[model samples]
Target: MIVTHEIPAIQTVDFTANTTYGDFRDDLVRDGYAVIKGAVSKEKAAHYVDRYHDYLEGFGLGYDRNDPSTVKEELLPVINEKGMLFHYSAIHEDFVWGMRAEPGVLKVFETIYDTEDLLVSFDAINVSFPNRKDITPNVPWPHQDQDPERPGFRCVQGLLNLLPNGDDDGGLLVLPGAHNISVEFHEQFKDEEQLYRWTNETYFFTDAGMKWLDTKGFKWVKVNADPGDLIIFLVEG
Candidate 1:
């Protein structure tokens, strides 16, 4: 069967700090990623879900059964048992813009990365399920947010939880301090073509390649946090 992906493309949000920017930046530096509890008001988080559905209604943009664009190309998403999305981020223009320019969200990055000139890479809205057994795990591997040539403080990714993240929900997991490690192994997975992996480790390289992660003492775990929390981590420069 032939497969295709039809999805709208847009940039991730770039926010400026209006409050709690200073405190959060420190947390980001200490931990690879920090979960900001209720980063957005319940009303705002709800907006994300609303805007998500709107994007679907307006553009007919959900993952087509025949075509895998929504999951493969957009976020490598895996639907959970409850029939809900684990990571879905095909957003409308309003949602993207408002999130990018979020004052509270951006403030933290500006201070920690120590640059007013921070930019966000386009990322997918993800939803990971708790206890969803991945016989073939497809976790998002450790990599910088920006391109290999320029991976670091200048470019970062922001993940904000619009919903509740209890123990049941498999929160995001980042390898602590793996940001400072070398990108040499990342070279193999560098190809933008490495998108679909329905079987193999969704986020792992070859054995030779994965050996690199072990060298640096890679640590992977769910990014635990309540709703309205956001996490920003630094990439290598």
Candidate 2:
């Protein structure tokens, strides 16, 4: 039931504007995901991108930002097939922390929770490259990060795009409004065997589940964002 289709148009918002904060909130509630335009200035994003390259090249493993051949797994950090660099303390890097502390990034969560006091998750940075001949194709693992036992908007996930994410650029693909029916779906599949048993935080959808979503008229959408834009979505969605 892996539905392959053309990417949808970009959905943009202005979370930086006080006037559109409510509109952004409403969109997240209804659509399960929203992209905040220019969450960080283009210049800042480019700087962060440079920092990422520096971090990679700092390994001295022969990785070169200018050479694609140097992107060999043996010459780089332990990046997963999905191009997520979770090892080498990448999450605690200064550039990552700087992005987390960005005013625009913090304001969105503050407005959502109605509080300035908040904690952030040290998530992995994705550097997915297309048409790589060195490794297997990156497969899309469609799953909800929310545990069904304790569901209903437990957390919101944000992806700060440091690169140009066009319709063709591989990024996040979300099932719109599927969060509204998550509870029902989980209840129906409670007795089914879990694919990822090591962690209760992630629940991968089965083919039957995809069929169910299709029956409900839900379609997967590829979220597009420019450099410095932040795409936020519900963990339960």
Candidate 3:
């Protein structure tokens, strides 16, 4: 059975507004997530999408933007079970780097870190295709990216949307206000064996942790964004 949870709607910050930075920071502190609308121009985002398809088609492994049938695993680079493309040097691509260096994108990080000297994280690009019988369905993995040992905020995760991501379109789902109690949650489940053993930077919440979130009335929110928009969220302690 597919279990569904009700998520509350959230207002995204307007990037062009001069007063939204404070609101964005406030959202991060209170809700654990914030969205900046039109961080990059829509036209530029469309170009980025085209470039992304170019990268895939350049592989010459039968992947084609116009043909959905060609999106098989054999034709594409290594994509994780969650539809994340971290391999095939996707991180080093020029377009990806360009998106990272956008002024609006950098300003958000600068506002959070309070300095211009910032280093970007080598993150993955997500390419989720719906109703694909050729690929495995993405499993929902609820977890915090923060290491338990590091109690306070260390880093914020950001995603630049290249396409319209609405409710039906799969995107980020975050537990609202979960970051406030992340430290306590980790301490409570300190003895539980981690689900993901590859890295300490990620702490996968167990069934008990989900129950804990429930008790706190923290509901999962499906964060939506348009092309050229940026979504930023804390690592949840």
Best prediction by lDDT: 2
CA error at residue 152 for candidate 1, angstroms: 5.2
Q: Which residue pairs show collisions in model 2?
A: none
Tens-digit lDDT string for candidate 2 (27-49) = 78678898999989999999999
Taking all chains together, each candidate's TM-score versus the true structure is: 0.57, 0.89, 0.88
In order, candidate lDDTs are 0.53, 0.83, 0.80
Give all candidate RMSDs, comma-separated: 10.5, 8.5, 8.8
Per-residue alpha-carbon lDDT of candidate 3 for residues 64-159, written as tens digits (9 for 90 to 100): 999988878898877766778988779989989998998989988887777899988777888777766676777778877866876666678999
Model 1 TM: 0.57
User: For model 1, how does the per-residue alpha-carbon lDDT over 175-214 read when each residue is reduced to its tens digit?
Assistant: 6666554355456456545445553213334555456577
The full ranking of all candidates by lDDT, starting with the best, is: 2, 3, 1
Question: Of models 2 and 3, which has the larger TM-score?
Answer: 2
